[model samples]
Target: MNFLIASVSSEPSIDHAPFILSGVLLSLVVIYLASKIGGEISNRLGLPPVLGELLAGVIVGVSALKLLTFPESGSDGSDSVIMWLLQTTLGLPASEVSAVFTQVSDVVLLLSELGVIILLFEIGLESDLKQLLGVGAQAVVVAVIGVVLPFAAGTAGLIFLFGMAPIPAIFAGAALTATSIGITSRVLSELGKLTSKEGQIILGAAVTDDVLGIIVLAIVASLAKTGTVDLGNVIILIISAASFLVGALLLGQLVNKLYVSVATNLKTRGEIITPAFIFAFAMAYLGNAIHLEAILGSFTAGLILDESDERNELQKQVVPVADLLVPIFFVTVGAKTNIGVLNPLIPVNREGLIIAAFLIVVAIVGKVATGLGAFGQPGINRWAIGVGMIPRGEVGLVFAGIGSSSGVLSESLNAAIVIMVIITTFIAPPLLRVAFGISPDLESKELKTEVTKES
Candidate 1:
């Protein structure tokens, strides 16, 4: 133990004892407070609370406040004390502690995945399947175009501008493919368009976009790992994803049927909610094992359940859990981000930033055209559809995290991706309002109408 301590000390300035205990406690409190304040501010401005939460994170992180900083090799920085303390408490090497922190970040990420899945499930549950079917082709077209264009633009631009190696650039483009459906959903809900036919198509298309983005991420990850993009692997992933969806739907139907039988016969709830949660987690695990995103599994579980009968009850129960866990995911996402890494004082390459900027533009423009994919749908403005798809939120951050951990993205690239995420999230609300021509007073009336209609 003494030898180990000496070795650890030789490498860095971490004191190991007080740092670990204090850091964890401090991090939790800061994250909670930041999220609360950020969420409240965001709601007041008609923005997704996530934007506020992230901004709060930025405020607390190294960028503005300089309150927290991750330690770097040979850097004489104030955050080094905190970083050292974390290293010592974990009783691991500095690198190992960083790895552990990254893993913990994944737990938060998993919950974020759950949040998006639930959001999508809610969309599916509320949807008129018949109406969705009618607009399915249009949604598919728009989603595909929306995904394809941005991906191509981002990949090409990164290759040309940043001279990034092929695989990393491809990963960057794949990262841009994600659309934050929650952003669009909230905006539409505010605009009183959530029940509109266009709204339905947009929601459906956003789902499609997310699924496609995940596939692309998997492919990019595989390519980065092996230095080859295998057609067979891509085909297999697609098949697996499709199979997962179908299997989930089938299982959901079976479960719903069984529940109906039992409920009708016994007139008991039968602790169905617990099993539902179990099934959701199980699906998420299975998805990970299959090299697909866990969110897909959670979403499939939501789609499979008896929405007609249990939707409200399930939402009420699940939302509280989502509320508690999901914010940690977002706040942790902010915590992991170190904006000081972007400072010119840092001896990092700037090419990543240039590539990141190009990709950000591509991400923005690509989804905007998805609205055009709403072609021939009455009362649907393609621009609105496109704007709705702009918020990258948690999904984009997930991709960035994957890329960073896998070495497909360097630190500078990761920072750039974080900046892009912030921009995309920040821009969505105001742009959404403008696109839909929704003013404050008009929005108030619409909200009243929705409340009354629901009542």
Candidate 2:
């Protein structure tokens, strides 16, 4: 009887494994399908692709029918099996099987980071060094105002609302200082203003703003962990960033020269393309080792390769990998977001929604102030420049993630940040169209010509 009972216990049963696998697979399918459908709908409605992707995430995540769920601990054997399947796919270890669905969440965050890097690289590739130089002064003024105002406003807001938590509030304010160039670039591109003087200034200013934002994030992160901010470390970070740019610029010149030399003798396209990705990845790794954001390294790499003869070929090769990795990031970000955590009945809970509103306002008003910095420039609408800088997209989420992981931001704060990101991104394209006077049936030829002249 004991032997028979042991045999019965050992018998495998078709349990929850299948359901878990199906749910994860369906989630990916849904995200992809949503991307396709959303892209079409967004373009037709004169909106950015990111807005569509976020809408899709909201639909699949919590706004529409809720298909995904974070399973409770001590689930049955079938639940364990399902969780195991998701963990396996996400390459998460068995130890974290209890939070199996979070694996999908991690992937999305990873992709979002990857997306911003590629987006920056593409912007670098498309930029004309001479044009950027010509607009350098204006860009500097705009970038400075853009960073300072937001930092001040956000910090003050956090202090007034959350009280005197120096570290958390500082970090939260730092998060708000970022201007996502991706959203701005998309709106400008769509409005046929990408090559305009104002567009060039906004683009260049954005690059500057991002570099400053990363430094602030690093300092804030360090302060949060160490309980004090080191002035020496902050100075070192600034020097390092300046050195990175100077080194990249010098290296880019050398690479351009070498490419010109080798272009005549090159046998295959792969020879040029392969080394580019190797360099890009290597720079990214180096950035991480130096305690800087990895995307900063990738962006720097693109800037170094900007004027190379092989730049186009390299961009082509790198773009495909970027495309695949990017969506995974977005989908994973969506999965990690637990909308159920928000409770309208609780006062602390209500604080999140209120904070979200405040952030959206800060994000909008901060960029708009950049237009004032462009005050003296002729034929350039300062309002349009500020409007272009409105969308936060992946970069804002990245800040939120860093804050949350570092314990600078609570779970409620992270959710509020996500909502702010989505709202700002959704509003940008339409506002940009209105600002730039772009018609629904605007042709690419006109935009292309404008872009060429700007370059």
Candidate 2 local distance difference test against the native: 0.66
How many clashing pairs in candidate 2? Answer: 5
C-alpha local distance difference test of each model: 0.67, 0.66
Worst 10 residues of 1 by lDDT: 69-78
Query: Candidate 2 — worst ten consecutive residues by lDDT sum?
Result: 69-78
Residue 396 displacement (Å), model 2? 2.6
Which RMSD values do the candidates have, in order?
Answer: 7.2, 7.7
Over 1-455, each residue of candidate 2 has an lDDT whose tens digit, in order, gives 99889878875543444444554565566667766676578668766665566566555554344443332111222343335555556554454454445554344444556665665555455555654556678888898888888878888897887673767667767777777787788778766778877788889887777767765665566567666657886687767766766687777788777655665567886677666666667777777677666666776777777778776776777677666555544543454455544567876677777776787898889888888888666556777788877777766766765665556666666667777777877887778778777422234455887999999
Clashing pairs in model 2, backbone N/Cα/C closer than 3 A: 16-78, 108-329, 108-332, 108-333, 111-329
Give one digit per residue, the lDDT tens place, for model 1 in 350-372.
Answer: 55556557667887988887777
Q: Which model scores highest in lDDT?
A: 1
